[model samples]
Target: MTAKFIVIEGLEGAGKSTAIALCQQFLTSQQIEFINVREPGGTPLAESLRDIVKAEHQESVASETELLLMYAARSQLVHNIIRPALAKGKWVLGDRHDLSSQAYQGGGRGIDRTTLQTLSAMVLKGLQPDLTIYLDIDPVIGLARAKGRGTLDRIEQEAVSFFERTRARYLELAESDERIKTVNANQDIAAVHRDITQVLEYFFQGLN
Candidate 1:
């Protein structure tokens, strides 16, 4: 059987870690060999880039610089980790992937879509997630939750408008893509888990 690459995407505090745990549990119940990866930090080199990108810096980080760093990390993870694991028929569960770049850099940071498209094409070379689950939440509530967690990272410290743009872009992408599903994350944890499980169950059922 062919391996499947699944991605979980959401704004900050959208409960992605919990969702990933649930995914791992579900896959384990099915006896599916799988590996979990997080964007910008799956491999050693990528983790280094992730630190550079997220750290509070004295110098202003240009939007293009941020974009390039993201793609650089993604390229490294895709080539050295994701692809090789998939080739060995191990299911790959990603905490975030290209869609984060499209939403954060393209929409939130107001980067040109064409530039993003070019970078994606060049870096990904036609790879895509078999399924993407997007947990949708209002930026206000999401930010509050994120703040409660502790100090915010660089990207997480952006203005509310930035996250609003990112959330809008996420919804737009989910609407356009059949393989992408949106879950209302504003709901309670139990409700969100149920919705996510339903989506995963439906997908796995179709696979059978």
Candidate 2:
């Protein structure tokens, strides 16, 4: 079977980590070889970019600048890690991808869609996730969960309204894209995992 790229996307504290773990288990059970990576990371340079993007800065960071930095990191990750793994016939699982940018930067930051599309076209170079599982949750609940983990990052520190816009955008895009699957993440942990299993099994069947 040809290798596939899968991604998990969600707002902060939407249980993406848990969902990703479930996906990993599912893949392992199927005896599939895969590598997992996170966006703005997976390579030395990209990891550095991740730090810059996450760290609080004295000066306000421009939205456009943040968008550009994200794409640069994504470019490095795609060329150096993602594509290479797929070429070696290993499935690639991503913690986040360009859709995060489209939702966060475009919807939350109100950046121009044209700019985002241009950057994505340049970096992705026709590559896109074969499947994306978007864990959906209310911003209020998600933010409370994020706070429990510790201090919030720069992006996570944004107002709840920001995440509301981001969530709206996520749902809008997910509805329009068949490759993106929405999974309710507000349920009990076990219930969420069960839903994730169903999503994965459906995706696997499609593969055959």
Candidate 3:
């Protein structure tokens, strides 16, 4: 089977890291070489952008500035890292991708969808994930889980309502896109992993 790009997406505390680890294990079992990538990161310049974007600042960050920074970081990762890795016959497991922008910037920040689409078209140039798994969770529960980890980042510091909007958008997009699957992250960790594994198994079977 050809190498495919897979993305794991969710709001804070949705267990994306654990899900990514599971994906790695699954790929390893299949003997498929893969690379794990985190959005707004995965490259030197992109990682720098990530730090800037996530850091809390004295001044309020404009929605436009936040949106542009996300795309800029994404452009660097896709062109410099993701595309190259895929070209070399390696699969990519992404922590987040364009969908995050749609949910966070568009839904949460109220950015216009047309602007996002234009930016995405310019930056991605038709590249897209072969499959995406969205771990769905309520903002209240997810934020509590995230807070338990450590200090919340700038984005994570957003109000619970912001995440509500974000989660709604995630579900909306997932329902519309067959390539994206939604897994209930409110369940126990093992159950979430089982659901993810089942989704991956179904996808891999289709590839045959």
lDDT of each residue in 56-159, candidate 3, tens digit only? 98999899999999999999999998999999999999999999999999899999999999999999999999999999999999999999999999999999
lDDT of 2 at 207: 85
The total of clashing pairs for model 1 equals 0
lDDT by residue for model 2 (1-208), tens? 9999999999999998988888999999999999999987889999999999999999999999999899999999999999999999999999999999999999999998898999999999999999999999999999999999999999999999999999999999999999999999999988988888998999999988
Model 3 lDDT, full chain set: 0.95
- lDDT by residue (tens digit), candidate 1, 1-208: 6899999999999999999999999999999999999998899999999999999999999999999999999999999999999999999999999999999998899899999999999999999999999999999999999999999999999999999999998998899999999999999999999999999999998898
* Per-residue lDDT value at 151 in model 1: 97
Measured with C-alpha atoms, the lDDT of residue 138 in candidate 2 is 96
Best to worst by lDDT, what's the order? Answer: 1, 3, 2
lDDT of 2 at 127: 98
Candidate 3 residues lying further than 4 Å off, grouped into runs, are: none
Q: Highest lDDT, which number?
A: 1
**Among all windows of ten consecutive residues in candidate 1, which has the lowest summed lDDT?**
165-174
Local distance difference test scores for all models: 0.96, 0.95, 0.95
Each candidate structure's TM-score, on Cα atoms with residue i matched to residue i, is 0.99, 0.99, 0.99
> What stretches of model 2 exceed 4 Å from their correct place?
none
